[model samples]
Target: MKIISAGLPRSGSTLVMQMLKILYSDFPLQKVHGYIEPKEGQIRICTYRHPFAAAVSNARIYNDLSDEHLKNSAIYIRKMAKAVDLYTEDGVTLMLRYEDFYLNRKLIVSSLVERYGTKFSDMLVEKALEYSSIERNLERQRVYSDFAHWDSETHIHGGHISEYKGDPTSWRNYVSSSQIQILVSILNPVRLRWGY
Candidate 1:
């Protein structure tokens, strides 16, 4: 089946693309940032991260992240969430959580294959998990300095998903308490809905 992967920044969109590349070596998977019009029978797998963490990553990457920036980010995130939810309700897309994929790669693959009829194998899934491991991807960056520029022209620190000090809440270190409160206030609905 045809597939397109889209997500907000730092939501493991590249990782999802890498996993799909390994899991369905023959299938063409498009890695994109925003929505693309899928052809018939095409399935879009949209990835999402906790909004607070995403906002923190944005701040780290872009470095501006003023109050206005966060407000705009919240607006954009709400629009993205609405689109993902609407598409999912219509069966045109599947929403995958970055945290879930990182913690339960096999289960995510199995569910996709079973529920969405995507052709995939357990062995391939295992291999993809290993191939997409943080260490391997980081090594890739080391060997090919160009790999540092994946989704953006500027260098992004902490490109590795596992670089968060072994804690999901490590974003707290980057953002201030007031910023966190603002992010939480803006994204509370989505946080509650997504159980983050």
Candidate 2:
């Protein structure tokens, strides 16, 4: 199986990937390339890149893809979902929801099985089950750190998207305009699909 942690930056994708790495320390990964090549019979994944790589590399639509541009994020999300489905038909790219994923580990596994076919082995399923239980609280850190700092420090922001007291406004300064456009273009559809 190939589970892509597809959430946008500052939305816990890296944090989630870091936690998952603890469980699969033996796996060969490309953090820069955004890919993971696991052991034989083991699962592999490319968190942000594989899906957005195409868009990021050759983005004809350089706009923010904000509600102003995309107009209907839902429509775009469905389209992206269908595209991802093509790569995931045989389970090469499983869409792991970051929201409910943190809520219930076992239930998430059940859902994954149902969506990807329940034929996965108990061991692999167990690994998936273990994914949500890891101990990592970068969000909490981001929240705590946000208030303590001001000035130029805020420009180097990271970790959580809504850490600025649920104020996404801080993201405006944290992310570069160009990068913002890239992410909005790639992730708004996802946010729309996810109803974010």
Best lDDT among the predictions, by candidate number: 1
Instruction: Candidate 2: list runs displaced more than 4 Å.
Output: 1-12, 31-42, 45-86, 105-136, 139-161, 164-196
Q: lDDT per residue, candidate 2, 56-143, as tens digits? A: 3222123243434333432343345454334434455444544444444454446545654545556765664454333324333454
The local distance difference test score of each candidate is 0.67, 0.40
**Candidate 1 residues 85-161, lDDT tens each?**
55456666777877777666675587678667877656777798987666666665443323244533112233344
lDDT of predicted model 2: 0.40
Candidate 1 segments whose C-alpha is farther than 4 A from its true place = 63-72, 142-148, 151-162, 165-167
Q: Give, for candidate 2, the lowest lDDT window spanning 10 residues.
A: 52-61
Worst 10 residues of 1 by lDDT: 151-160
- Listed in order, each prediction's TM-score against the native is 0.77, 0.38
In candidate 2, which residue pairs get closer than 3 Å at backbone N, Cα or C atoms, i.e. clash?
none
